[model samples]
Target: MKKLISLIFTLTILVFQMNLYSQKIFPFEIKEHKLSNGLKVIVVPYNSPGIVAYYTVVRTGSRNEVEPGKTGFAHFFEHMMFRGTEKYSDVEYNRILKLLGADSNAWTSNDQTVYHIVASADALETIVDIESDRFKNLKYNKEQFQTEAGAILGEYNKSALNPFQILNEEMQKLAFTTHTYRHTTIGFLEDIKDMPNQYDYSLQFFDRYYRPEYCTIIVVGDVSFNKVIYLIEKYYGDWKRGSFEPNIPAEPEQKEERSKEVKYPNKTLPYLYIGYKVPAFDSKSKDVAALNVISELLFSETSELYQKLVLDEKLVDFISGEMPMDRDPSLFRIYTRVKDEKNVERVKQEIYNAIEKLKLEQVSPKKLADVLSNMKYSFLHSLDNADAIASTLAYYVSVTGNPYSLDEFYQTL
Candidate 1:
């Protein structure tokens, strides 16, 4: 235990030195503004001439799903937004995207929904006009709503086919009680099945969560702040603010271990997943930073367990650890795929032993430095393009309302 504490002290010193060196080199000249309607816009000018990345981040997701019966609307809106506005039918929107040579997509998660497009810099005005129309004047009939609901159910069924997805669903259900995080972003199966009949409720959900106050528009690459801001204000100015605020219930502390078992009907390798409750994300917190490093220290491929169970003994086909940055307290999960059913018990013991070692002794300085350096360079390398940079900023913006939180996060490491 003293060795473990000493390791923590060493890691803290290393992180402090790294933070000092990084303080002088902030990555981007991020300019931010807020419209009267409470819509935020961030502009970053990069050297990539004649190309731009535009993003609309809605700060609502499964986390806003407080009602028991109306659970899936957060994800439902991801599909609904594509159904198009009164001015542009779904077919017309596709045609517009094709003509402009734009790359576009959207995704929903535990805390936010993001819609994005990459297109020629010259098409900025057209892109703004079309995207603004959908957010402000989106319109759909009951028939359209029902059709999308059916499609969502189909998607849930498809996900159920995957054993990993099944495990994740069960893990979430077992780990969380009162918190909406208990359900995946796809939401409860029953909620999705009944979504078709909740057309009116769908409209309410959009009105409550899709307001201007809950959204941010991020643009990076060959663009001027003046031009982007002017265009956004002109297009999104009339979008109204909302007064509703969701009182998301918090998950109580877990006092004992939780476990579940499953038997896939089809013959397949046995799988195991374990989750331990952790705190809500704070980019500057040392505890969160340590947990993030512990994930690497204990389970990363260079770690002792991976070398023994995966590459040497070959008892496991796959193994990984995840510590997600989330708006609420979440789980630190370990997953393993055992090659043979008979080896499952031994593999579980080995994993437990690895955790015990982590709690008892400190990781080597060499291993800590290597993992931290690799993670640093990995992030820097990912900034090779405008889309990548924009995507990275969108994530931080959703988490802390400031893209600079990315810097603060790495510094904490």
Candidate 2:
């Protein structure tokens, strides 16, 4: 008994040390500067020679669309942002990017919209000038706005063809009653169809959300913090802050479980998604940490449930679960696609059984330690390049408006 106890104690110390060492994996110093206009600049001096990943994170998304008919405007702006400013037309912007051999794109999510560019370090000044100009002086007529809105409607119709998309739409709608999360980032089909008529409203959406107060500029690569800050100030300093605050309605606590079935017009394998209401992400919360651990323990590929349903019985094609960090309370979801419709119930029961086992039995300390170690190392391994580091930080920045939250969240894990 004494020998077993000593061994466990030693193992615990080693795991603690490993986690501490892993915390240092984010090797570069993160320098942050806030402009007087409320724009934040985060610079990470990575060792990648002559390459830079520049990201502009706007802290607004479909979640800000609180009014009834404005659901898809946030996403619509993702497309419209490229329409260019008075200084640089869409054609001119493309020509300049091609000249610099840069790759640029933008994406919108439930909580934020991000625009990213990967270019040479020397082109940073031009990058800042163009990006800042677009944000501050974007110019588009009703014709251009309507054209993009129509394109978004077409994109929505194309996405509806995917069964999983339909399932996700149904799941979100069934999960919440009041929160804007009830809608997908692309928003409702009806709202998307009405988008063309909402061109004037689109301008208002931009005016409300596209401001220095709601923006962060992240520059990662072989860059100097002083130089980055200087360029940002020179270009983005005069941008005015807007006073609009979204009056997002709080979601009432769910008292009962909800379920919905989405019928796909096209033939496809049966899909199952089960979600439980989880709290807003807090890096210091033990409850949130436990949810992350439980997701891996019950559903990851190494879990007993996965071995039984996927490898042994061959019932499910894939099984996974995630409780992604969000600005507001969100769902911890388990998803699977069964090979046959008849086995869907069986797979669901097997997942439930796994959850019950976790509740009834304590996981061995050694096993728990191993899971934590793997999770830490997996994340550390992904920070291999400048773009990867910036992209990773962008998500944390969008959620909490702080890049260091990544460290806090990892430490909590």
Candidate 3:
């Protein structure tokens, strides 16, 4: 334990130093700079030939929604961003992308909304200016706002058709009561239909959150980090920071374990999911690493229980578990598909027994090593994609305010 702690301390130091020497990162070089207005810039230089990916991560998501009856404003803005700016109309924006031979997409997660694009690096400046303009000065009126709100409602309708999304919305609502996580990011249908009534609030929302300080810009692939930084400074230097730090509520503790079942309109097979509150990601905490190891041993595919339950006996069609990562204690979710609802308790018992065995038995040496190795390979594989690497950095930055949680995580593992 002493050795492990010392190693963790040393790893933390290295990561800190690496980030500090932000003069110019090497081997997929990343240069971190803060604008006068507070937008964080991460420029990654790669020589992948023609293709480049530009990602803008806005640090506000559903977690930031705390107003009464305004559940999904963050996600709603994700739709509104495309409505248009004074300079770029909707058709013009789409046309420019087509002319530039670029494809663009954006998504809102629980903690952040990221706008991403890939094109020839020659179009980098245009993409940067367009994104900056949309973030800084958006143009939309009542008609556009209601139109997007209606579109979001349509999206919610489509998602409600999928039992998985429906149950997720139901499960999270049950798992959280006070925090905005209680509502699906798509929001309650009523609040969405009423979004137009809150158009003024929507404008305030944009001014309060969509600032340079709340955003991180990343450009990767076949680019010069030095040049990209200057370009960002030139185009986005004047962009302002958010006036108010989002007032996100902390979730209250779950006093007891909670379990729920959802029978969908299209139910054919039975699904069981259990959510147990778990500790958050504390890279410095050994106990967090232990929980990670515990989850891997219990539910990872190579584990004996998974083999017995899903591969050999076929009692379960599939099984998976997640310590739903968060800035606070999130749920450790156990998901399984069984023969029928009658088998739910039996499946639950088997999983509980597997967990119980951990207290009575330290995992086998091979199993423990396999679990760690699996995580290492997966983390390494994820770094191969430029977009994946950027988004991963953005998530850690948004969630923990420290991007090197990835390194400290491995040290604990």
lDDT of 1 by residue, 59-151 (tens): 998999998888888898998898988799888998999999999999999999999999999999999999999998789999999999999
lDDT of each: 0.86, 0.86, 0.75
lDDT of 2: 0.86
**Each prediction's RMSD to truth:** 2.5, 5.2, 5.3
Backbone clashes per model, in order? 0, 0, 1
TM-score of 3: 0.89
- Model 1 deviation from native, Cα RMSD in Å: 2.5
Those runs of model 3 whose alpha carbons end farther than 4 Å from true positions after fitting are 1-28, 261-263
Q: What is the lDDT of residue 325 in candidate 2?
A: 81
Candidate 3's residue-wise lDDT over 187-259, tens digit each? Answer: 8888887886888889888888888878888777878877788889988988766579766677876666565
Candidate 3 weakest ten by summed lDDT = 1-10
Clashes of 3: 1
My TM-score estimates for the predictions, one after another, are: 0.95, 0.94, 0.89
> How much does candidate 2 score in TM-score?
0.94
